[model samples]
Target: MKICCILCDRYFTPDKMQIKKLRKHPHRIILCPECHERIAERVRKRKKLQSLKRHPEG
Candidate 1:
């Protein structure tokens, strides 16, 4: 079954293109490649913030 991206609401056929998981649900929803990259970057930034919160270091 095809799923629509949570961000852009773009319809995508799973059989046609690669669908990358943006984040683990309950927040997770399907995302297109561009959205996927953007989300991934956001996740990375959040992770960095988490790490910084845990330990304040250089």
Candidate 2:
């Protein structure tokens, strides 16, 4: 089955393992690797900024 990435809307065919997982958990959605990495990077940057704002010692 071809699944579209929820973040980027990129359509792609998932691997066999992912297909099985999706079937087992239909509520779960698939995220493309690029979008996943981008999201993770953004979250990390945001967390770092927040931490700096919370503790502006140095």
Candidate 3:
């Protein structure tokens, strides 16, 4: 199925599993692979920063 990424607004074809999930939950937001990876990397960096702030190692 053709889906548009909410962030990038680019059209992409989702795989079978993604299609099934979207069908099951229409309210869910879809992101293209690139956008998804970008967001994931940002989250990982944020989490690492938070951990470092909580526990400092010298």
Candidate 4:
């Protein structure tokens, strides 16, 4: 079976991954943990940039 990447919306075979569930809806979907971590890291980075923009000294 191929697992879907929630971030890129691509399908990769199970043989090529470390699968994980989408935190918001864990039961209905699956993704490779690396992809999930990348997505989360991107979000975190974006949020940090936004916060920095809001508070220039911080």
Which candidate wins on TM-score? 3
Tens digits of lDDT, candidate 2, 1-58: 7899998899988888889999999999889878878999999999999999999995
Where model 3 places Cα greater than 4 Å from the true spot, the runs are: none
Candidate 3 steric clashes: 0
- Candidate 2: 10-residue stretch with minimal lDDT: 29-38
Question: Which is the winner by lDDT between candidate 2 and candidate 4?
Answer: 2
C-alpha lDDT score of every prediction, in listed order: 0.71, 0.90, 0.95, 0.69
Residue-level lDDT of model 4, residues 13-56, one tens digit each, is 65422333333455765666678778899999999999999999
| Regions of candidate 4 where Cα sits further than 4 Å from its true position | 1-27
Q: Which 10 successive residues of model 4 have the least lDDT summed?
A: 15-24
**Per-candidate RMSD, Å:** 6.0, 2.2, 0.8, 5.3
Q: Model 4 RMSD to the real structure?
A: 5.3
Per-residue lDDT, model 4, residue 3, is 65
For model 3, residues 3-37, the per-residue Cα lDDT tens digits are 99999899999988899999999999989999999
Model 1: per-residue Cα lDDT over 1-58, one tens digit each: 5678778999767533343442223355557677888989999999999999999987
Error of 4 at 31 (Å): 1.2
Question: Which should have the higher lDDT, number 1 or number 2?
Answer: 2
How do these models rank on TM-score, best leading? 3, 2, 1, 4
Clashing pairs in 2: none
Candidate 3 to truth, TM: 0.92
Candidate 1: where is the Cα deviation over 4 Å? 1-4, 11-29
